[model samples]
Target chain A: MSDKPKILILDDEEDLLATYKDLLTNLPSKPEIYTTTNGARAVAMLDAEQFSLLITDLHMPEIDGFQVLAIVRRRFPELKILAISSVLEEQYRARAYSLGVDMCWQKPGTENEIKMFFDCIESLLEERPSEGFRGIQNKSLVDLIQLECICRNSTTLKVISGGIEGKIYILDGEIIDAEFGNLTGDIAFKKLISLKKGSFEYLPAVTERERKIFSSTDGLLLDAAQTIDETTAEDKSEVPDASETGDRTALVKPVIAMSKIDGVDFILIGELKSPQPSDSWGVDDSKNLHKWISNTVQLWRSFGDKFLCGELKDIFLYGHHCKVVLKTKENKLLCAGFKATVNNETIPNLMKDVIALWV
Target chain B: MGLTKAKKDQSIKLIITKPGSFTVDANGNILSSTLPLSVPDKFIEIIIHNVLETFLTARASGLIFEEVIIQFIGLKIVAREMRGGALIHLTPLKP
Candidate 1:
């Protein structure tokens, strides 16, 4: 019957429940907090009370967190739910996002961190369209493509309107090449960016092809942005006739491009940390890993001390779920983790770019 | 009788060169494949072309071309230059 908003916190550990309950009570909003150790009891509380937010841990003994999330999502479609756990794998985290969890918080530290966490919960409750890809309404094509590259998304964007269709290929977050009519690469990319109106569909596809054109993703995006800007600045009345217009008048300076890195999970720049058991790879393959590491060092030594060996590179192992790419610059070692789905052609450029950064 | 039976077997699962041999064009398009149809032609063609291109470049750079081998977690791919194209052999090492 209190005027304060109620929050439900569920966890298997009583101490964790106590910690959360204590943290929530001291917030500036002074939220009314309730704790339940079991998921079924939490469901019962959900049925009985009208809570504003639900924060549940994923790994529980009785009626695991995913089930609770499904029940809550189906019944209370508007209620915001957060998935928190200690062992958060990449795939598990991806699954949670797909299931409509507002956010996934790994662990909480100091009081200030807890307070910041509550702030995020409050923001999500306010309901902003911030997560996932949305239909392109008011957004420009250039900005959208740039966003995909920045996120390292592997997607093929199809644009179709007024019987004009084109396909842009993006792998490992870089614009590899594009095809529209008989055009390819920059010519095709320019025409696609010149479109006035079109509905876009992004299909995430696995790609393995030799890149016909070479230009940095940022460079291509910048060219598109500049073209769009130039077109917008031109007066509609002064627009030249189609026959008189020259398409090749504007040329973008091309920079040598790096290789695509589609499925790399993590890029370890130094010595390997004591990998957690939850890792999809690591410590479990220590013997083979040690041999691979020793070979990498020996290969570096073979280059001779006076050779500088700044450009030294090697492929440690190319497994299904794990790939060990090693590059040495000066004394530092750069290791790249690649998923099996990655295009093998990108490995050399990936090594070169990482070495360039380190040097 | 043996020729007729061999022709029927090829229709069911083509084995032009061997069970896992396949060929791609200069542009990496699938020209012919003996592998199962479930494995997309484009996927196989591009992957084979990319892997072989590395060895071909080495040959072009004056390195003696013998053979290149790639061992993935569950599969092993061995490529060797033959005629004007590369002969790719795929073997599943694990389930």
Candidate 2:
């Protein structure tokens, strides 16, 4: 109704409300600041009039910030909300985040914190009218993820649909972890990606949660797509034959080709992100080799970092009895063993040719 | 300090030179090394230990393998388990 942006400040302490009101009123935009000592009164005021932003304190008597956030987010999805707490525990902030509070932080105390708090408010007010990120609506989470992954962004995507909310964390284009209620990692990621309709918001940070999902974004999305297809097929037939044969066969094709080379003892193919081997032949224990590769990859990754030699794309082992070669492709691996009789001078060129073709 | 081949090279040559190598005993101690002084023994220990542990683990799981050659970009490490000890060679080649 007014040209000046309106912001609602809800806190139990009248003094803090006055302080925040005083600080926000001096903003360059000179926004209209509506301050209320009571949470219910703040909600009522918000309902009565349009507010550009909602800054609510988590600790309160009856209508706590969590409850207020839940109600306000559902009723006023478009309103930019920031939840603050002096208690400063992760559980409170995490709960607020799940409730869809736009920006959650521990209550500002230091000068820098105060400045950042005001800066956040000013930006929120500035973006009040713009449609850039009030909410990323209509676009599926997959599209948003692809965009972020391609940019190699480190951020957390929060998706809300049908009142269900989930968070997917991406660090350097890789989907490291995800959260949806009690579910986590790959299960959570699959569940979230399957969400067809949702408003997604992303923050420029990765979660502190332990790395749960190890697959690359492409691998994860591929798996998710396959999983979704399998689920849909289950409804169509009484006995749903959801097998990875088609995909696994494609993965093993190159390995099989290498295995057929002269003097090649066996070739094992495995997804670099997964623990189990994708396919193998002639090797006595493909699973064990995969396990060794997984562990060895971890070690080599560290070595790569220390030496600055870059990521390990392949490994070659030579012994008196045999010559073994391991090559890494996108998200999978190829390990081939050759007889001692094979020409040592020709193996590298031949292996390189096979690797060049494997991709 | 490292032999890195240009990507324009179509083939990877097997004749990469080994710059340094070391031997570690059953106790995981370094028996000998030709690596430069700048190369930390700690690094060599860790690498040998890792290779040895993984080899034993894999062997326990019924996977019998005697030699391991690992290649990374232009860096390579080849190790062979021999009589309760391991001989590890570090090679820096552009292939």
Interface C-alpha RMSD, model 2: 6.8
What does the lDDT read for residue A126 in candidate 2? Answer: 84
Candidate 2 lDDT score at position A135: 50
Per-residue lDDT over B1-95 for candidate 2, one digit per residue giving the tens place of the 0 to 100 score: 13333432323332324588888887888888887777766667678877787567656654555777676666777788877678888887664
DockQ of each: 0.01, 0.22
Q: Supply the DockQ value of model 2.
A: 0.22
Candidate 2 has a TM-score of 0.38
- Cα lDDT of model 1 by residue, A1-359, tens digit: 34466788989998989988887787666777777777765765665456778999999996888888877765554456889988888887887777667789876676786777878876655554332222455577787888898899989898754346787888988888887888888889888887655556877664875476589987887888788777767745465544455532222111111112344434444433222211121122333343344344443344222222122234343444445465554454455555556656676566566455444
> Which runs of model 2 end up more than 4 angstroms from their true locations?
A1-252, A283-285, A319-322, B1-18, B61-66, B93-95
Q: Which consecutive 10 residues in model 1 chain A have the weakest lDDT in total?
A: A251-260
Clashing pairs for model 2 are: A315-B70, A315-B71, A316-B69, A316-B70, A317-B68, A317-B69, B5-B94
Chain B TM for prediction 2: 0.74
